[model samples]
Target: MFPIIFVSLGPGEAELITLKGLKALQNADCIFCPETPARDGRLLSRAADIMLQLDIPADHIYRFSLPMSKQRMDALNAYDQVYAAALSLHHAGKRVAIVAEGDTGFYSSIHYIYEKLQAGGTPVEQIAGIPAFIAAGARGGLHIASQEERLTVIPGITTADEIEQLIQSRSTVVIMKLSQCTDEVHRCIRLHPEYDYHYFENVGTPQEKYICDTRQIEALHFPYFSLIIIRHNSF
Candidate 1:
């Protein structure tokens, strides 16, 4: 049976890749990576450096763009293309590896590919890796959650109103994808002057940057691979 291995690239650190993820990539017959054309740039490119260290051939690495606009038909069609590519490769007796950041199971495109493959009765395998939350916590010296604290994780793209509401109610909130919604997130942080907030970007990358200030950070440059932790006090 051909194995479709979903490999997590980790939070922009080569050492963060699991031993299993590295082994699979070394033996992979075909590799698939996701692409995003945000004005800032692509997060997967950081993973590409790992692939380079392994000296994988350029042709062996293929990237498919994830639809970004509000075109559902085109988006679904793109997903179908990903499904078709993997399916075709699996049928050819090749072990396929799909790469994602953090872990494949957490907000990874591999989930979409996996569902489609399962529907077609394909054998699949998953290799987990470190998540961004862990790395963010480590970088900022913040503990993620305690037994008594309810962890509320919100995507950074949430509307200003929704973010304001969450910050008002939740004592501990972790926000992901802060690079895109910096201004809104900045505003939300200001509403609570007494709390401690940490804004970390590129959590484990060489270019990682962070700030632990309640004051609104204006035009604070942040990488797309980021997480924000807001905690009121000890839980």
Candidate 2:
């Protein structure tokens, strides 16, 4: 039986992929990557870009449009389709690698697929990568958490009330996927001005930008990959 490896490509930079991940990609018979809809109606795959940067041949790479909806039924269907494709390849005696952005276990779609594949008795290996929040903190000169302080990572799609409560508890907060709920996040920050906050977009890439003032978050257009870090009394 062939092995399936889940490779994390890091936050955004092509060079940030781990040596282990690179080796896995190099050895794999086929690589599967998630593709997003581009502005021109074409699909764009970050994993493909990483492969190109590493000089991997295009013939070994394949792109799949993974579902990213919040709906339950749509999400289930998407996972099933992707898993079936991977399983088909594995049964063909192919070593497969699924490339994901950021850490495979941290709010990544790869996690769902990994769990499903494992439950079906398929052996899977996970390759770790740098999470976006960590990269954001480093770029903004902010420390996410220390000693006894609690760190909470919340998806921006979470309700405003939950976010308000989390911020009130004074935990170091990291809000991810901010593109969908920027207004709600802005309100949460406005309610808690005592904390120092920073907005980071496309960290470690050429488009990377850091905003120290919470006020600026509302004016700018946030990408789906953007994150916000709120530091409570740690300035």
Candidate 3:
């Protein structure tokens, strides 16, 4: 099997791609750029965008359309298919690079492929990129965690009771995958008005923004997937 590498292109901005990640992409025999089907049926890849910003050639980049469904088996099967295809490329003596967005170890689809590669005994490496949450924290000048306080990252699918319980700990909570649980988030904010709330959208990109007001967040639906950070004012 051919050796493979996972390159992280941080969040939305092209310049966020790390120096190491860029070099890996430059040296790769070919690249698989992960993309998702947009609402308009167009395949969009943030990795390709970042590569362009870094002056990487688009000629060898192939579209990897990862199925973005909540159905567990569907996505898992898709990952397996990609894994098989990657192995085929490796067999032809190609050193492949799969460009990933965001950090490798944090909720990345690359996790599936990485594990499969491990099982198959292929030489693989990961280039870490800044996670969206971390980038958002830096952009908004918000301290993520300090002293004895803890930081929790949860998906929006979390139950309301679970969310309320988490807030009671007075720790910072970062909410993602918010398309499903926006109402619960608003309710949580209303229930615990003491905590600071900031809504971040398209973090690390030119279109990035944050809202300090709960009312504004409730009134608007972000065009892209967004993150909501709730933290106690202790710091």
Worst 10-residue lDDT window for candidate 1 reads: 214-223
lDDT of 1 by residue, 146-212 (tens): 6766777777667656755655665577777767677776666566556677777777767787788
Return the top candidate by lDDT.
2
Q: Which residue segments of model 2 deviate by more than 4 Å?
A: 72-78, 159-161
The list of candidate 3 runs beyond 4 A from truth reads 222-224
TM-score of each: 0.84, 0.90, 0.92
lDDT of 3: 0.80
Question: Whole-model Cα lDDT per candidate?
Answer: 0.75, 0.82, 0.80
Model 2 agreement with the true structure over 52-152: per-residue lDDT tens digits: 88888899988777655667677667667778988999999999998888999888866888998899899999999999999888887776787888889
Comparing 1 with 3 on lDDT, the higher-scoring candidate is 3
Best by TM-score: 3
